[model samples]
Target: MTATLMTGTDLAAEMVAKAADRARALQERTGVQPCLATVLVGDDPASATYVRMKQNRSKKAGIGSRSVVLPAETTTEDLVAELTKLSEDPAVHGILLQHPVPAQIDERAAFEAIDPAKDVDGVTTRSFGAMAFGEPGFRSATPGGIMRLLEAYDVPIAGAHAVVIGRSPILGKPVGMLLLASNATVTYTHSRTTDLPAIVRTADIVVAAVGRANFLQGDWLKPGAVVVDAGYNEGNVGDVDFAAAAEVASLITPVPGGVGPMTIALLLEQAVDAAEAQTA
Candidate 1:
């Protein structure tokens, strides 16, 4: 049986519409538009495009956008200082630091500079801990989006065996934690994982977040396993071999339209939530 596609475009749009309504209401009540501050370092074309896309979506959601572009040679201290300033800004409800800042900057250090209250992208250590403990707090945007997508499609999560093919702090690790919180048994694998395909075959659900294009083959999937491709490599290719995996898996998410849109939608929605909480 051919796999049914789990398209996130429509769901993301619905979520964005709801966020826009909330943003409007918040503005009406407080005279303050929910704002999202984005920090970008260097001139990576791909990162620039992602930042632009987020800013544009924020506008559509009735959220104000503050863009901070730092030089490629910026030191870690400077970046931290900038993040701290944004964190303390009462008008800014959410702060997102585009990933892969630069080789020179201490990425984790900069992430820590963002106040947990304004960490809408959920990169801070506190946010990660909160998510791990299933406590109330902002989730890492992409993982949060992935959970929403799974729920929207009515995919059974609890008690399922989920193999996550990455261990990145933001995407892979957190997604696995979320699945565990949903009662799914989680196995995390990284580049060092031996017999990766064999592990994948045992999963009821497979999340490909290794950042490699077409890294997971179709033969690796169980006949009815659900696939969520969270990788967006060069040329829009995903971690899974989409065409091949679709022939075997029961459900799959495509690149570009799957996790990407949902991520931005959740970021905007969380920004609105932060605004309301801070004001209240």
Candidate 2:
């Protein structure tokens, strides 16, 4: 039997359109459009493209976007000052600082400057804590999107063994917490994990977010497993080898067509949510 490919792009587009309608209604009701402030430092081509894509999608979703482009030589303090300003601006509902800001800039310091209420990207430590403890607050966008995808597909999560590879605070770790919140038994593994394939073989569900190009192998997947590939590596490749994994797993997400689009869609949707929350 051919495994079902769960590409999120089409689904995400549908979600964005639905969200846009809601955002427009909210704007009409309150005369306040939800705005996201996206901060980019230096001229990394990939980062530039990602930010542009986000802004375009946001506008299409009836959400407003503000961009800040800092010089390559910008200091951490300079970045923090801008974030602080955005945080204090009631008109800006969410702030997203694209990763790999610069070696000279302290990324965490910049993330912490975003007010929790406006932390739509869910990179702030405050949001991290809330997610870890299962408290109510904004969640990391990509992780939240993954959950939304699962729900949209009607995947059963409760009592499932969810094995998550990678442990980064923004993406991987937050995803594990969310799986746990859904009552899944979660196991996190990283580079140092011994016999990684053996561990992955036990998972009923798997989430690959290690940012490596086709790192997870197909043979490692349990037959009938539900797979979520969160890696957006160079050339639009994913952590799990989609061609191979699809043959093994019951449901698998493609690299370019899977988690990537959903992430940005969720970001814009959350930005609108944050704006409405602020206005209310």
RMSD of each: 0.7, 1.1
lDDT of 1 at 195: 96
Q: Please, what is the TM-score per model?
A: 0.99, 0.97
Question: Taking the tens digit of each residue's C-alpha lDDT, what string does model 2 give over 115-136?
Answer: 9999999998899889889997
lDDT digits (tens) for residues 18-103 of candidate 1: 99999999899989999999999999999999999999999988999999999999999999999999999998899999989899
Off by over 4 Å in 2: none
Candidate 1 lowest-lDDT run of ten? 1-10
For each candidate in the order shown, give its overall lDDT on alpha carbons: 0.95, 0.90
Which one is best on TM-score?
Answer: 1
By how many angstroms RMSD does model 1 differ from the true structure?
0.7
